[model samples]
Target: MGNKSSSQPPMKWPQMPWTDRLLLSLVTRLRDVTCHHNGTVNRRLFPFLDHCTAANPNPVEGVCTSDITIDSSCNLYVRVFMPSDPSIQGRPIPVIVYFHGGGFSFFSSSSPPYDALCRRISREICAVVVSVDYRLAPEHKYPAAYDDGINVLRFLDSDRLGSIETVTDLQLDFGNCFLAGDSAGGNIVHHVARRWAASTRDWKKVQLAGAILLQPFFGGEERTESDIRLDGAPIISMERADWAWKSFLPEGANRNHEAAHVFDSIKAGIEEAFPPALVVVGGFDPLHDWQLRYYEALKEKGKEVRLVEYPDAIHAFYLFPKHNDNTKLMEEMKGFVQANRSI
Candidate 1:
């Protein structure tokens, strides 16, 4: 693991654009206040700043959302969303299991940005969406979030939702399921799908349709060209990205760990093991090369995949669903789902 010291030199946000400087200042303040010497995050202020929390009300119109506790023991939970589109009232639509991104240490299923995104997805696609609130790192660490993801799939396959009075009236077609996430959440989607594909354990009730990774967070010890090229890019600077990995990855695990580097999967033919995928890359984002490399590797492995690049966009564009780039992304997502959905 990289050094865990919190005494590193102060960030040089003044050199960045005013907007980017403000963004960096706000995030740094939050981290300074919530994070401890041991690297755990408190994050009580996130909901207020992001506009919601697990306890906050759902503000998106045309979508009905409810909370579910998949494992009471660990407080593992998820938020279920269904579109209010009357046309699809009794129709069984595809199910999308979504994971939100915050470098694996922050954010939740209820964070306003993701809430808005999921709301748009369910409303537009007329599908059932499950927003997972996976445990974060430093406190929960790697594999914990991955395990919660896998268990959610297990819960679905157990037919347990049939007993939940809240979701009983909803029509969810399990046979058409997809995994998706942005940044760190995208990393989770990859791992969860890998686990599902490699395991004999059956989630036979649901078919894994595809994976949609938007600006997936990946890293390695060997720095790539883009990492240096966009060293201090807005939202995700090289320093910030390195800190996130160091803070989240398991102790003693370096950037080259399979969990952080998707290329390791290629050796075992695991890229082929993954479901068909749509990988979205932001033109100016620091992680662009890593994301592109993963996409190219998948194609080389002969796995069905597509690449979409927003040449002028930056990281986490999907936070604003109405933005032109994000709108294109959502449309692409809907098309991918419709194409692969079980008939």
Candidate 2:
């Protein structure tokens, strides 16, 4: 574990553009930015800000985006993006299964920001991006999202995905599939990857290549240095996180629940089956220590783990294009996918 002390050396934080600084200041004023009320989300109240975007199959410059239903029973769907970049068109492309972050209770895969992020990944990483639209909480609760995550994997391995028109013509390399998410979605990636590793289904075509977790939402019963010091910081706070946990976790479950605190309950054997992992940590994120803990836990279990740190980053810095770290992240991700892809 890294040092969890009160006093630390001064580290340079990223300089945000003026507009981003104003937006951050404004967001801090909200009780909880993503419409948390009465233990459930009220998307209607913030419809303008939290609006969804319809998927379009029509190619726009270098890529194409469309929606595919995964499971109608649970209202699960995914926004699929295929790269049309000249360099990638002729070759078989890797697939990335993405989950969006909204503290678990909010944000769908089709949310405008998430949609935009996936498009860039598809174009720059030269891979197909399947951003999963899992059910949310205070209603669906824990395991619902995790279950949805794994179900998407199953769908990819099955015959159904191949028949979809948007994906049919494109050469998708499922054998090199990677799971990625940020914040709460990052938490989901861990559980889903672990579950897939344990599944008895001997996958002959689909292989879990790598897990890309960006500042994964993780917690414990006790607070760490980042949690204590970064409290009330813009974007994320301890109070808001606690409420999210209360809303998402099963009734009466605390922060130490298996979903939130992964370091304690990990059993043997899963690590060997688990794919190589790349965990990204932001120096300014309150969850920094927890993300580090995740990397350390994986390393301790004899798993191949890579930790990428941005000393000047805040939580979800990848969302806004104004931050230079966001650009760096894309390049880092592009490199990871290229290096970890199946032969």
- How many collisions per candidate? 0, 0
* lDDT (Cα, 0-100) at 334 in candidate 2: 93
What lDDT score belongs to each candidate, Candidate 1 first? 0.78, 0.82
What TM-score would every model get versus the actual structure? 0.87, 0.91
Taking every candidate in turn, the Cα RMSD to the unseen true structure, in Å, is 5.1, 3.2
Any runs in candidate 2 off by more than 4 Å, and if so which?
A: 1-14, 22-38, 165-168, 267-269
Model 2 residue 41 CA deviation in Å: 2.1
In candidate 1 the C-alpha lDDT for residue 253 amounts to: 81
Model 1 scores a TM of: 0.87
TM-score of 2: 0.91
Residue by residue across 62-81, what tens digits does model 1's lDDT show?
A: 88788889999988898888
Clashes of 2: 0
Q: Compared with the true structure, what per-residue lDDT tens digits does model 2 show for residues 4-121? A: 3557645555689997786556444333655555677665655666567778777775778878888888889888988766666556889899999988877788776788889898
> 311 in model 1: Cα distance from truth in Å?
0.6
Q: After superposition, how far is residue 68 of candidate 2 from its true place, in Å?
A: 0.7
